[model samples]
Target chain A: MTEAQTYSFFLGCVMPNRFPNLEASIRKVLPKLGVQLEDLEGASCCPAPGVIRSFDEPTWLALASRNLALAEMSGHDLITGCNGCYGTFKDALAVIHEHPDRLKEVKKVFKGMGLKFDGKVEAKHVIEVISELGPDYIRERVTRPIKGIKVGVHYGCHLLKPSKNRPWEQTQKHTFLDELVEATGAESAKYKDKNLCCGAGGGVRGSQVTVSVDIAKEKLDNLIEAGVDCIVDVCSFCHLQYEESQEQLNKELGEKKYQIPVLYYTQLLGLAMGLDPTELGLDKHVVNTQPLLDKIQD
Target chain B: MTDSISRETIDSKDIDPEFVDEIVKAGADRIRTCIQCGTCSSVCPSGRRTAFRTRELMRKALLGLKDEVLSSHDLWLCATCYTCLERCPRQIKVTDAIIIMRNMAVDHGFMLPEHRKASQKLLSTGHAVPIDDANREMRKDLGLEELPPTTHSNRKALDQVQEIMKRTGFKDLIEGEKMEGN
Candidate 1:
């Protein structure tokens, strides 16, 4: 399939609600780089792959198909900032392609609603789009590197899972996300369990909060032990876990606060592009960033 | 929380003859193919802290231990992080397979309450995590629109989401369960 030069932006539930700044940064950075982020207007949730899909496969397909139909109507590929939304769109796209009977079932439902999902629209993540922008394009464009800042990269599971489905780097020895982190001149700090999750997927954080916080607490401990200044992630769900769970982690552990700030890759990229950190929404972060920002070479 | 629970000692009556096929029909087509390598279990992030052994779960699914697999709280312990799926040597699609089991569990009227609340929120608001006032101020701070062009801002689109939910019985399936909250 020939990749389209322009794509519709698929903003899932979290970005619009919990982290609008991340959305603002993506909008500010990508257009300047020549990637058009068309609004996927009237789009609903990706219906949350882990939660909704777990209960009923056909229901999940119908919901996902509705969003894909919206994107297919727009004549551009869908580019999502969230991994769960990406996984849902790509997984639904894959199932329909692999199973005609399923597609027929989903289409019959769409027919009742006067919409169509032709499976022509490809669901691309913003990270993959940046990588496709090529390393040199990013390197040459860097106007101000927040040089010497160590970034702990969190590649959320949904972004690169079921290896058969996603378009990101190969699971083994993956550096696709890392390479993008370095494009800003901030080193991708080596942390144990870097490939592990932020412990907030599959509705676990909502249902099993203790278990979810336990897993993230370990990952953060590992991150801090690695001496990284901040966390950089491509998916907002992981950002939510890493950013929101720290307060809970400190409460549960009865320990000193884990105050590491979480930044989406686009915010880091915006800083490298010489965009004001306030315009990138850095000041609105849940965790403190003053010490981390102080260390940046500016 | 996990220390008190012990692995079930399987007996002949524990096996439901059709349970394996039922799982396959649910989309985990390769459950019987697991070689018990313990690779999936070792790499599972949830497995390390919780009793959710991916290898053991597959063994139960293959052995047709329906009562043991569905009735245990350990069933819901997987974070669906796909770490096991990434690490699975057999390429079992472990996370998806676990979700298939969860669908079966939901059918049997077994589900965590927190998940049910989220499902209810999705049905009602069209967004699973609906917008709150704090986020509204944050959006204003970023000089963007208060609400995204989503169901939260559009009623007709939300009705479309509910229509899909109703047509698919997702509303009933999620709301039908009366499990006590975890």
Candidate 2:
């Protein structure tokens, strides 16, 4: 029989609550592309940059390995929406794949949880899979083309950093997101500081708010400086930091020189795929996407 | 009590005690293994931007310069992108060190009030910060809808967070906040 067309979806922390719209959009859009997101019961945070940073190596190894093992058990490839989840799983797999000794240690940690990870499963960021699936196929599947919507692309830190196993390599010049957005007939905004971080990293916001804001401010200021209509990103954490920090920074800067809505690329993709604003959960983000919705609806 | 206090306290004449050692013994046990290779420093984007140095922070932590590590803004400068942890030769969890320092600072009342205010907002509202009115107007101007619904406030969600934190001993670590009262 043909292999099942389903995937074990890993919705890391923040998606269910902080950015429910992004999740909704993904769920609404993926099915149209013939991808079925299989549910895995009882999955926890990737504990990335969080537990991994704070705990012993074995603890982090076991924690991330446990997440991978969950996907492995579900008999479908592990597909995640969060950038941190993607990075943690890919990083753990790389570590275990490269070091036999480390794999043994991870296995020992898993054994304690009465689990064993043979490292056979594949971990993919949602965007990586989409990019691999080819923009042409994506374009053909689009029921709605987001014409006239000018969008700024935020590739995020984890996905862009390390750049290992990046599905496409453009040595001279490449904008993976811009290319994809254009495939939907949307205009990719030309923004300076298009690559700055959202400062959600290092668990900084959770521990040190001042630092986190300081970091996010740099990115927001840059995007505003560029004059983008809206910010679109693949990582929910980046989406959260950028969306929330833009509002906070506007207050701090004492003038509303910039106010841009944040969209998980999936939500934007959902729109391009002809999904309705309500179906994509656009009403749910604290940053508000009403303006974008109106533009699309109009 | 005076003798015990004197023994525990350092005078102006004493060398700066190894504060990093104290933290390591206090469960940040990965300090001594750091190799100070500068891999973390070079790889850090913020370090590249602001001269933030994780290697220097690790060195200070290794030397037990508690006051130096906690007071210096370097720890705050990290974005926690995990680049250092990925590239570290000795596999030092540089970002985790920063978190530990922040918690220690907050516990000691060294935290900025703004940071505390934000945390309170998160604790109460299940969000890190509030949305500004201008942002609301901007969203309307952009034709997007109002704030979306959330799955954060439910007992199941909160309980799940607590359970995970418990599993990771993260609650106990942050619970160190209470020790500040003493």
Candidate 3:
């Protein structure tokens, strides 16, 4: 087999702090599929959904630009596990790409920090990379198919928005993640508000808890009502929000209510690639994947 | 009942006199450069969903109509996706303004019901919601041999987060239990 594609992984804020398993799962499986994930030195948060944007817009852009600079300086395009980071990085690039004046200002801010981004490095979410690898490549790598499983895919806002200069081009004719999910032998289903916020946005979870949870609850209800066995997310924040928020809502409602497990797309792929559940950080997710696990036929 | 606040921009001098300077100094100095450009609103996920316009919020904050800016439901609708902040031609920090307004709202006790309920849950449980119980029960019913474990927090993470919040000037935003009813 040809050597795996090597990439510099950007495990944005939520993954490190709340969804460590996402990085852990991708690390476990990518090697098996001949993909090498190199760690970028001293990478900080993409500062997407985490940083307050309005009050310190330049600072926020400067921080994201700093991350892009790291990858550019290292001579590797940045790959992120979180959808939010993908959006933020792409948005930053778009800003610098569209306006020379703004680019100059942002570049000046980065210059003081000893970084220069010549815009050579591009940002991509894991799904985009998988899509580029194509379904045939993915299917060939799968040693164990996650059969008998139905997955509700939550693409999250950042993964699918602004409709201009997407991190990965969308043809208005293609469904990337859904195709990849099916390649692993699991059914990729959609729910209402498939593109809705997980209510984890805007640093809302820390500041505006109820609205955040309510937003999460909306996602949960839609996924449950759609009758999927589990929900899979590309964003760590959405994964945590759906998993944790659903549990809290069920408790308040006083019943087992919606018991759908939430999975990182990497975890599901890792399982298909024959990595053990323990190795994939399945044991660490807030949402129980026991239902989906039972269906794994391991 | 208070009269509806107008979105009109009165003369900068007629407004709180210090309002424009204060907002500019708060790091949103680009408010005046907004040009009523709908770039922010057009790109915002929340704005696309619920007409949550950040430009208007900036206008209000710039005018120092603090009450109107903080009390509006628009700030609550922001998803913090940063699409607006990223798209703003003038580079206005729209999401940060919403956060500042939310902080202001918490101070004035205008926090909507959504903020109140979730805060209580997060405070009582380290998690915003307890997922452990569901996992235990679901594993049992599914006849799984082992349940996935919950990641333990040593309070350091929480403390670190609190320290950041304190430093950011929202130290008491959570509103202590003693002050719950009062």
Candidate 4:
């Protein structure tokens, strides 16, 4: 009976470029949950916090503020599906607010473009929006409950770090994600070092993929040990790492050691909503998601 | 009968005393408050499998070992997950400090080649990972626009992004002098 919550969807590079299925999943699922997405036209990258910010803080803030300014023009808060992009916008805003001088510099850069950022708009992760809607709201919409699937929830970094800026209370251990996962009637498995980094952030993946995969191997090992059907992640970058690392490990080891499917949270939630798996882009994953699909169908 | 052990010690002359202040000014205001606590390193996921020691890196930065700290590849190994920042008893912005140190490292020409390529991509296209023909095709097949109304589909928007990069010196940072190896 109420109007849909409208947000300017900030699509970072990874999802739309490398993994369009994650983009597909978000676009397909959110509308069914009473959320309407508006494209932030002509928006660039989140500029990526790890790489860009590491090189030059001022440039990072300038680029991020430009994105924020675009969302302000639309008169809506921006919501991103990637943790990296979410981190960049949130961290940039925090820096600008905390240091007025930096905001002044950002505003100076904007002067030439006829853009202004009053810090009126904010950035949120897709998880934050869905979770804020509460599990009960999501629970009511489930047409097909995936009661038997056990999931390893990977709460990739940047979703809950620098706790002072985030809405969540506890950083180390949090159940908001787990609660959402359970809402689909799936068990959110307890795995070792559940909150560990996916090893792809901070430019490590681009710089040294071998090291990044090695770090991911640890998390994958823990998830495999926990006997989960698949790895459900909120970040597209982390999703890429899990899917790519499994394939990379198999290639390097010359064995099919890892085959666990990686799903963005929406893809999993879409299945519970009885949305077609192909429509959600489950067929696009590197690791086979059929086993999870078959289990849910059973 | 000679001892096989070789020891390397830092020379006082190599220490840049103002390096700590440089990082602090860059916005890691709590770098001086570190008490040699290994909490950051201990919680680091990368430290377990790699040679990255977060606490030791912080210690070196605090000691003003500018050359040693800035030139080390270990600086890039941090995943920037902020677990250390969350757990730091001193409430230090440990990860932010590391990121600032990376910026300083890049300023001194110690950038990774991959990062240089990525920055160049951002300069050229509005997105770091720009849309390609394959993704374009996939997007259409997925019932969405080939280009999702971003800078890819908007020329003026892309130009605006490029202009911001130019004004911020990001374009120069990527296109300027050849940076040193990582």
Candidate 5:
């Protein structure tokens, strides 16, 4: 068995504030997977790459560096469940490394806070942590094995983008997430535009709700056509877009059209590990996950 | 009729020849090498539904159309998925250029209202989306703490984040009365 790993957990705004359920799932599953999560206490927002980075580059770098500084102080690499946060941390770090001037600027800001950041801590995604465990190791822990359930895996950009910084082999046609989904005893359903954005990133969801929901509606239409039991994703923001957009689309169309439940990857893995659905926060989803639960029972 | 005609034509006064240099300096170093191959736009998911044509935006930036580029509503439409950046044959950081342009836009006081609200939230609570009563209840129900150990629960941490924002001038940037600098 591989040695257990520990990380300073960076909880961005959405998961803890909007959907504590996803946070609950991660807390429930990672311990069983031999991953320890330490709270990066007092760590503020990943400052949200989409909104903050767009508004001011310098502030984005300094704030991201502060969070990285906290993790460095904790002596562990930082890991986040949201792709937007992951993108901010990774993109900010890449910028800091590429431009010495930016790093100097961030360090100057850290100086006042009694903090020192040597760019030691690396930002990681939860999926990256699980992927390191290998699929065989994951399969061995499946107590319930959610067999016959079809899942549409939504990678959501930022997990694999700015390819130069990411560790993924291929950004466009990557299958690491699909392979992980299959290990949970659930079939990763093939869908149109599988890599399409859930339409919530880059502050588009905040500024233009209709357009954001319209983008999500298109992807949901594709997932519906593929007959997936649920849409599993790695980002809480994407999870919110997928879940809320379905309800919004149904309202706009004046029909109960889109109903695909959205599940964070850990939630799916937790279910496969025989954890109770309630403990996984499946009961708190915007769209009912009872259909998915019924499928697993059958 | 005059308004329509003016909109159709590019005015020389609107172009700032140094704009491309500013974007390049802001970290989209390969943007000037764009060949108008349309690969970025072709792969852009936002372009499919919105007017966010990545190639067109790059062309405008290269042409130094500062006023037109910064003030366009289409500028905020990019989802920043980086699909365009990944598919660019010139290895141009297409999305990064857009983000750089967005920073420039905000510097020029062209930010969206919603974004300003988000920034305000960050300054106030250290979270773009601050925890509400309902969220607190949900966390309690989940057997988690009423607040996660983030800036929301820790006042000193929140102070540190606010300090960073203040030092970075982000507090003033968003709190300033006029976003358009009229």
Candidate 6:
């Protein structure tokens, strides 16, 4: 057995505030897999990479670097449940590390508070951690293997795009996330526009709700066409987009209502581990989980 | 409403040649490397519905059509999904270049109201979308602490975040104020 390494968990804003079910499920599942989730207390937002980074570069880099610097202080690498946070750390670190001038600026921002980024800590997405545990290892621990359910995998943009910065998914051919999704005995369904945005990213949802939800509707229609029971997502923001779009699409497209539930990756993993659906916060989903729950083999 | 052609002659005098240079300065130096390839436009999630043509926007930047690029609502139309970034054969940072243009837009007071609101929430609460009462209940229902022990729950830590933003002059930048040198 490989010794599990401890990681300081960087809980990005949306997970804690909007999707606590994700926070709980991750907290519950990873420990059983021999990974310790240390609380990176006092960490601020990954500041949402796209929203701030698009609006201001130096501020985004400095703030993200501050979060990374805190992770470095823990003497362990960092892990996050949100792809947005993952990208913020990954892209911010890559930018600052590659450009000494930017790094110096970031250091100058940190100096007043006595924090420094030795550039030692690396960011890992929750899926990356699951991948690190290996599918075979994960498969062995699945007591109540999910069966007969087709899942559309939402690989949120920051999860894999900008391949240079992200350690996982270096190429479009990378099956890391798909492999992890399949380990729990569910079929990772092949869906349309597999790599499209969930419409909640890049501040689109924040700035233009109708347009954002419309894009999600397009993705959802594709998912429904592909005939998936539910969506398995790694990023909470993307999770929110899919979950909300179910209702939004239902309203907009009259007489062709689509109702699909969504699960953050850990929530699904927790259920496969035989944790009570309630314990995994399954019932907390905006869209009812009963449809998917009914499909679960007793 | 008339279906008529309205034409205006454009010359080098009507363009800001430094526009592309500004975008380049913002970590998107690959702007110069774009080959007018329409690959970005084809892959754009935003262009499917909105008038945000990725290739045309890049071309506008390439040609230094500063006013056309900056003072248009179309600037915020991109979702920044990076699909265009991924599919661009030129490997142009298509999305990043747009972001750079948006930054330039903000400096020129062409910022989107909604983005400004999100940035404000981030500035004040250290979150783009702060915890609401509904989600507070949701967090409690999930058996986790209502506040995730972040800057939101700790005022002192939030002060540090604000200080970092202040030092970087990010607050002023987002709020549409002049930085010290300006």
Q: How high a TM-score does candidate 2 get? A: 0.71
Lowest-scoring 10 consecutive residues by lDDT in candidate 4 chain A?
A1-10
Across residues B63-132, which tens digit of lDDT does each residue of candidate 3 receive?
A: 6776676567676778766567656888777654565556556666666554555443333432333335
Per-residue lDDT over A143-249 for candidate 5, one digit per residue giving the tens place of the 0 to 100 score: 98989999999998889888888988953798988999999899998899998988899999999998898899889999999999999999999999998988888
Q: Candidate 5 at B155: error in angstroms?
A: 0.7
> RMSD for each model, in Å, please?
5.0, 8.4, 8.8, 3.9, 4.2, 4.7
lDDT score, candidate 1, position A280: 91
What is each model's TM-score for chain A?
A: 0.96, 0.91, 0.92, 0.97, 0.97, 0.95
State the DockQ of every prediction: 0.65, 0.12, 0.11, 0.76, 0.79, 0.63
Quote the lDDT for B65 in model 6. 93
**Per-residue lDDT over A1-298 for candidate 4, one digit per residue giving the tens place of the 0 to 100 score:** 1124888999989899889999999999999988899999889998898999999888888989999998888888898999999999998988878888888988888886878688878788999999999999999999899888899999988898888888897546899999999999999999999988999999999998988999999999999899999989999899989999999999999999999999999999999999999999998789998988988888
In terms of lDDT, the poorest run of 10 residues in model 5 chain A is A1-10
User: How much RMSD separates candidate 2 from the native structure?
Assistant: 8.4
State each model's TM-score restricted to chain B. Answer: 0.86, 0.63, 0.67, 0.91, 0.90, 0.85
Give the distance in Å from residue A231's predicted Cα in candidate 1 to where it truly belongs: 0.8
**Candidate with more favorable, higher DockQ: 2 or 6:** 6
Error of 6 at A16 (Å): 0.7
Worst 10 residues of 6 chain A by lDDT: A1-10
State the lDDT of candidate 6 residue by residue for A1-298, as single tens digits: 1125788899988888888888999999999998898998888889787788877877888888888888887777888999899888888878867888888877877885878686768888888888877999999999989999999988888888788777664577667767887899999988778887878877788878888898898888898899999998999899888887777777776754777889988888898999999988888888999989998864
Q: Which candidate ranks first by DockQ, i.e. highest?
A: 5
Model 4 shows how many backbone clashes? 0
TM-score of each: 0.94, 0.71, 0.69, 0.96, 0.96, 0.94
lDDT of 4 at A244: 90
Candidate 5 chain B weakest ten by summed lDDT: B1-10
Candidate 5's docking class is medium
Per-prediction count of colliding residue pairs? 0, 23, 9, 0, 0, 0
Candidate 3, A223-271: lDDT as tens digits: 7788898887888778878878877888889987868888888888888
How much is A123 displaced in model 5, in angstroms? 1.2
Candidate 3 chain A lowest-lDDT run of ten:
A49-58
